[model samples]
Target: MSERTAQLSVRDGRWTLYVALMGVPVSQWPEHHFGAGVVPTPSERSRALTGLGFVFTDGATWAWEEYPEQPDDDTSPVRLLASIRVRSRDGSWS
Candidate 1:
């Protein structure tokens, strides 16, 4: 997998985009249900983006860049960043 690649998942009415590194758990919560099958179809990806209030063009690939290195004291190799919601007006999320 690419260093900049991430996975998308929905749980408890919130959608999240995060990178999964080796030896790291996808999510601490068992309900997160990580490692699900990939969404290979661009149409489906577009649909998911639309449903999540993100702009996505069909047949376009979603790209991300490598994250900057963390502080020296942060020794953990595992890193994760996620956007739990994109369209919620009130910041309400599950």
Candidate 2:
């Protein structure tokens, strides 16, 4: 029930990490199917997050803060995104 806005940049390409968890939807997969019950295993989870290079916002409100290489430094802009996580009805979270 909360919402905010933020942005993030990569490769120092004229962008700063100002984005926050803007639109992250709730857990798509149920806690039981989320990689092995509530959360994924250390190794199994690590491998999944190892190649994370995209931003995903699921239309949900999230906590966000901006440090900006400086305050309101309008010298760069970051690309923000929106992600969607559909909850399965088969009592499975995958």
Candidate 3:
């Protein structure tokens, strides 16, 4: 088991959370949230990610509280882009 850094970005007005191992994308969540304020519950998102061996490397509190402000249009600003760390189920780092 190995771990690596992951990124969360906004693309095409959607949230995309992804991790790559050995330069290959291993896990990705393209629709982490339907909208800024419409984000899933922390437990719900965590449960979905845990299956991929990803636990929010940031504090749990932050994960729950930190969210990107929704873009009102294509030219709107993106305020919630972030990079996070992820480890394998066995607690190893890549």
lDDT, candidate 3, equals 0.52
Worst 10 residues of 3 by lDDT: 59-68
- Compared with the true structure, what per-residue lDDT tens digits does model 3 show for residues 1-94? 4546555555566655555566544543322443544444546555645665667654533331234355446555546545555666656434
- How much is the lDDT of residue 82 in candidate 2? 24
Clashes of each: 0, 9, 0
**Which portions of model 1 miss their true places by more than 4 Å?**
1-15, 18-43, 57-61, 68-70, 73-75, 78-94
The list of candidate 2 runs beyond 4 A from truth reads: 1-72
Model 3: CA > 4 A from native = 25-41, 57-79, 90-94
Collision pairs in model 3: none
TM-score of 3: 0.46
Query: Between 2 and 3, whose lDDT is larger?
Result: 3
- CA lDDT, candidate 3, residue 88: 62
Using all chains and alpha carbons, the TM-scores for the candidates as numbered come to: 0.28, 0.20, 0.46
Error of 2 at 77 (Å): 2.6
Model 2 has an lDDT value of 0.30
Ranking by lDDT: 3, 1, 2
